[model samples]
Target chain A: MKQWYRDTGLQARMFLTMFLLAAVYLAFISFLATTGVGTMGIVVVAGIFIFIQYFYSDKLVLWSMGGKIVSESEEPELHTIISRLCQIADLPKPRIAVVENNVPNAFATGRSKKNAVVAVTTGLMHQLNHGELEAVIAHELSHVKNRDMLVITIASFISTIAFFLARNLMFFGMMGRGRRDSGGIMAVWIVSILVWLVSFLLIRALSRYREFSADRGSAAITGQPAQLASALMKISGTMKRVPTDDLRKVEGMNAFFIIPAVSGSSLMKLFSTHPQIEQRIAKLEEMQQKMEF
Target chain B: MGFLDAFLGKTKLPKSKTKDIFAISTANVTFEVNLNLRALNKAGICFKPQASSHFTQARAEVEELLAYSCKDTNTGYQITKDAYGYTWIVLEDPDFEDLVSNIYLVSEGLIERDFGEQLLCALFTFKEKGGANVYWIYNFKHGNFYPFAPKANKERNSAFEFRLRSVMEKELPIEKDVERWYPLWDVPV
Candidate 1:
């Protein structure tokens, strides 16, 4: 089990992805500094906003999905299964919730271990069997155990700031021109756009790697890799059958889905939030073989 | 505690039989004092299934021993399977001491027969607070005992559980690790 954590190549990929994101952020900062558009006030404001989001992310995500916390009575089977898995994994039981959406998906979110919440869509409950559901819950628990939410939040903080700066660059640039140099303002605008583009790609890469790592972690916890592999296949197949209008509504939240909701176009794969389902299943099969030996 | 310690890479030792036996005594007292509920004169043995023919024969022998040993004491025995497929052998006696002794006899018989790995848990039931159901669960996996106070709505009453734990800590060999106190959630009456 320990080897599972140590051997996760996805972890290395995530680290590299974050490193690249940091490089982009630093380059943007340098451009702002050289062009005299680097304002202490703006940095302080962005930092505060990031900090708030970091702390409130779990609650925010759940609220956005219209999720409700379900006690043991409301979801006895789910509660029992989650508690049993927590027993085997030897971790504190996280809060369990259910979202009323028709989309079959689940995600774990929290600022810390104790405060974590795992929410599954109603569609997921209808779609998966007991074993497959256990696989999904175990996968989410892996994310909680690994502190993935904190890592992702920190890594994405800069990208969020770059997005904000880029969007409001015209106003900020005018302010900077009066206080400092117009040339510096232009450099800051240009740099912020570059930062937004590069960080966007890097964050997506990091998100994909984390999904793979979480999948491996789930397999180890349940000692059944095939369960999750099958669950992924089922979810991906169902995702394709959903109407395009409904899919478009949730396109922004695609990263939180169990299977990345995509039309299976090769072009779409280049910017997808998760690795291809076949690739993920192949990795799980590899792990299953390793476990047998 | 054993389960948590194992996960955290602590010492590995077989669960103490003494601790498993002792958890029942206080709940037995609580039944009489607080709720006017009689000790249903019963104890249960829970185990997993084994595929080997030898193990099957051994289980049959243990059941036979339990049947013969408790007949004279007016105690009854029954075996049932839970939803999760765990097998349970229940023995009943009005005398708490006889009930414990009978459980010990059955457990020892299984251990001697080399079916120890199948002994997953032992459960002692009690009725307190005017026939409210409560249980003391001894997990063989952890070799520890924890209180389980089930509410009417199927949720655990932590306050009642805490009170039971505090009052009976000395009488029962309580499990100290919080993680090992797994709630059985549902138990057959």
Candidate 2:
């Protein structure tokens, strides 16, 4: 399992993906900065928003999911498992909360691990056995340990701002341009739209890679990659039969879903928030076999 | 902190000398003030390896020793297996000192019988941080003691674990090998 962490090939790929994302972000920001489209002002406002969200993301996510922060008294077994996993992962225990929803899912949220929160639905508690539950929780803890929340949050922030700029360029251009230099304003809008589209795809690709990283993290922490692989299989199976009505209401929260809400479409694989479960399971199996050696 | 750290061979040896159980007694006060945990008067013996004829005789002999030695201590003992197949001999008493003494005596007896290899851990139970549930985990393999401070919703207060380590290091032979701190998880009661 530890060997997986030291895999230079995997690390090189991860670093390369990160480098590409950085390049894209820098190019977008430079374009906006050079064009004098109030990008600096937008960047300042977005920075403040991201800062606030980063600090309060765990609490906000828990609240948004209708989760209640539980004390050790409220859930001894759950606390025990998380604490043990945290010890193995060499992380401080993140805050634990439980969502009232009956969908079997779990997620980790926070800007950093110290402030992270690991929340699981009541349905998940009823679905998995102790070992399997530990595997799932360990997986979420892996996300926390790898600082995936911070990466994903930052990635999404740039894309989100790009999206806002693209959609509201005409409004901003009108406010700043006053019917003069219409060609310049048109070019600005086109640039913003292009930035938005490109950043959106890059953000999703980065997200997918982070998921793979978290899977590896989970396998390492738990020392039982097979348990997590099985858990993922079970989760994906349960996800399919889950009532879409309840899930649809929470569709906007798909970015934080444990198994991203699956929409039945051939195109879903291309746009889904998470990698296909089969691929994730296969990766875990590969690591499991490596550990056996 | 790296993957290599996880694969290193675990070193096991018989505890060189039996420490007086009086050390664990001090934790009652330390736990309350520092960790906000109440000592649950439940000390459990954890042994690894599946049950076999030799193990059964060793366990019985250890139990006999404890019953005879603790007759005046008023510590009640019971041997049971948790869901994970780890064997535990639980000793309950209102007096924390008596509980500690009983645990030490039993551990010493098992070691004397050459069954020390099967002795995995001895756990001193504590209530969860915000509630009245208990967690007692003793690592016999490491010969070092640590606390399992569970939170209300099933999380551990690792900061508290570190604090406990700092405070209790001088008082007990704490496990120096970090890997040996394998958590004794999911013990009933």
Best by DockQ: 1
The lDDT for every candidate, in the order shown, is 0.71, 0.68
For model 1, how does the per-residue alpha-carbon lDDT over B1-189 read when each residue is reduced to its tens digit? 643322221212232253467556655665467545456566787765543355567888988888888886778888898765557888777788777777778778877765554465677777674657777777654566788877766667888788777877776677787656777855664
Residues B82-111 of candidate 2: C-alpha lDDT, one tens digit per residue: 764456788888888888788788778877
Candidate 1 runs further than 4 Å off:
A1-6, A26-35, A238-267, B1-133, B138-145, B151-160, B170-182
For every prediction, compared with the true complex, DockQ reads: 0.11, 0.07
Residue-level lDDT of model 1, residues A188-247, one tens digit each, is 667777787778778777777767777877775565677898799788784354446677
In model 2, which runs have C-alpha deviations exceeding 4 angstroms? Answer: A1-9, A238-267, B1-81, B84-189
Worst 10 residues of 2 chain B by lDDT: B4-13
Cα misplacement distance, residue A26 of candidate 1 (Å): 4.4
Q: For candidate 2, write residues A6-78 as lDDT tens digits.
A: 4455555656766776787788777766774555556567678888888898878887899888876788678
Candidate 1: CAPRI quality band: incorrect
Deviation of model 2 at B142, angstroms = 12
